[model samples]
Target: MNFVHFATDIAHVSGFSALGLFIGLLLVFGIGRYIGVRWLLATESEHTSAGLLDGAIFGLLGLLIAFTFSGAISRFDDRKEMVITEANAIGTAYLRLDLLAVETQPALRALFRQYLDARLEIYQKLPDLKATEVALVRANALQGEIWSAAVKACEVTGSVPTTNLLLTALNEMFDIATQRTVVALEMHPPTIIYVMLFSLALISAGLAGYTTAGIAKHSLTHMVVFAAIIAITVYVILDIEYPRLGLIRVNSVDRVLVELRKSME
Candidate 1:
């Protein structure tokens, strides 16, 4: 089973979850308003002393949203930066192929081209995670072939400086590939964080509704705007976190690799 598929599925689920949360927030808000109205009638008091609790809950919700939103943006930037880094690394390593014997350059250069294609294909196949996984595996295999070919070419050269420089570039290139894979697959915050976020959002909505109960009538506009903003915020966060599978994406960054591949030709 491909873990990329799992991640993509999770992103899809999160998107749907955000939509559900919008409706749930509206429902919970109405229910809380009903309860608050009954409480107002029973107590016959215009004000309640639980202001501190409301502040705390809303404060916590704000904190969670801020942190998650920030983290998602940071991750989104990292993914874009990774694409550029990988492109540079591959280009550097490809250029270093000149250090090898004239006869050895063609095969290694061809491998580099194939490797870059595989890398690009991995993301190009996005949302179709099975295809992406296949591309990823192909890229990994090319990494090994490139390394082994480079090692053999270095041995053929029998020059310490050439071997060191060429092999170092190859190593960095492969390392960046591994790093990109890890970032794409494993860098998300724990699932519990998102669960807590959703829970807090709903709780905050309920509290907001309860507070608004003091008013004689419900403001449909205010309620809708509040729920929409929260839902959109959550969706954007998730979209940024899983850029490949969402409206917010790092696909533009792939152009770096595409340019590098064009240079190879």
Candidate 2:
């Protein structure tokens, strides 16, 4: 899971019963202490070596998280850019359709409107995969209507040039939509990797807490800062990976749909 999904999981964890919280905290401290003790004992370093070892553990955790999260964040930005590109592509195609004969406008616009609605419906169904599949089938069927209508315009007018433009625009629109879907699916966090990261993060957190007790003059602020950073970072990663929810969302294609609606006027 990306940062968003991970945050949801943590948010879910926060709601656990008191007993669960107690056990969780206990495990953190206990497991952490065990690991810290073994690690520190096995070392034959100087007296001030504890802090260094502890810092090393934290540093390693930071590195692992940064690497994974950086990739996720890059993908998140790419998804956003693709959305804008798709909107532009569709808009361009819609405008080009205007150059066709006046007789063709009404049917083409109507088909465009239906296509936009069907497209929006596809995303709205995304919360449920089964529903999304159903929506895609319907959307694809609508696209067929669009295809038939576009083709019929050229055949009726017997203008090869007009047909060529309509076909070009429709083809690009379809390509853009497919690209958007592929990006969304691919950008999601891999479940297996998420599990591994979480397991490691837990161990890292436990070790962090355990080693904390072994040190003196350890600022409460430092601990708070680290925890906050880790939690927030995890949450953001989830957001990027699961763009369907929270602050970063795969927005509905409302803008294009609204524009298409206006053409009816």
Candidate 3:
């Protein structure tokens, strides 16, 4: 996960929602504190057993957190690469438009330009199903218009094989656009993972605080550092999941868009 994108977005949105995710984390810590206090009261047993147990819990949680963190980062990178790949596909399709026909070339290029603009808009404003439904109606309408132009070109060319190439490019463009939508807008942290991680974080902290109680004055360092670690890691996960919504988003078209548009000329 792109820590920068996820953290900033969560900080802004969650902050506005009365600290949505953070408040929840805070609550978890609170519960852990309560549990630690209760457990300590119940067992004042300072056997080396307590320290060993604490060490084990910390080690396990640390390992799990590290593994999961790595997984999230890997997914984020995959999403980024997907964006670049999709952009390349669209750009390649657009350039292939030149292979159509003389009369069809300029008009086909115009249609591609419009499609790129529409696609960029979609990337910038994530499509809610409702809004997307409306936008898709418009997109379908635009697609019809574009295809009509392609049909005109094919008719002028009078060679099915040559025209087939243009049609194939159009199909490629569609696939790339659809792929972009998934990687850029919908790729997100799974809710189940979030729930599990959150639960684990609370459990870890409670155990850590409880174990270090008498031997340490519940050092502010550990709690603060843990919060920072979990929060930062989570923030990165979120950023990666939401590409278009943050600074770290994989560019929808990147250089490909400009290059393709230039090729049209």
Q: Best lDDT goes to which candidate?
A: 1
lDDT for predicted candidate 3 compared with the true structure: 0.61
Poorest lDDT segment (10 consecutive residues) of candidate 3: 14-23
Q: Relative to the unseen true structure, what is the C-alpha lDDT of residue 201 in candidate 1, on a scale of 0 to 100?
A: 91
Model 1, 68: alpha-carbon shift in Å?
0.7
Q: Regarding TM-score, does 2 or 3 come out ahead?
A: 3
Candidate 1 residue pairs in backbone clash:
none
Residue 246 local lDDT, model 2: 45
- Model 1 residue 100 distance off true place after TM-score fit, in angstroms: 0.9
What are the lDDT figures for the candidates, one per model? 0.87, 0.64, 0.61
Which residue runs of candidate 2 sit more than 4 Å off their true CA positions? 1-26, 34-53, 124-134, 189-192, 215-229, 250-257
Per-residue alpha-carbon lDDT of candidate 2 for residues 1-265, written as tens digits (9 for 90 to 100)? 2432344454344324223433444467556666666565544564358668667776777786787789878877776676667667667667766767779878888767777666666666545555666666776787788788778777877778777887898898888887766545655556676665555666666867666655645575665555555656666766666566445565653465556556545
Cα lDDT of model 3 by residue, 46-113, tens digit: 64677678777767667766766677678767766765665676677666666677666877777777
On TM-score, the leading prediction is: 1
Candidates ranked by lDDT, best first? Answer: 1, 2, 3
RMSD of each: 1.8, 5.3, 5.3
Residue ranges of candidate 3 with Cα displaced over 4 Å: 1-56, 125-140, 183-189, 262-265
lDDT of 1 by residue, 1-265 (tens): 3567678887889779889999999999998898778785335243545667889999999999999999988888888898898888889888888888999999999999999999888888888877888889899998889889989998998889999999899889988988887656689899899999999999988888888888997789999999999999999888888888877767878888988899999
Model 2, global lDDT: 0.64
lDDT of 3 at 180: 54
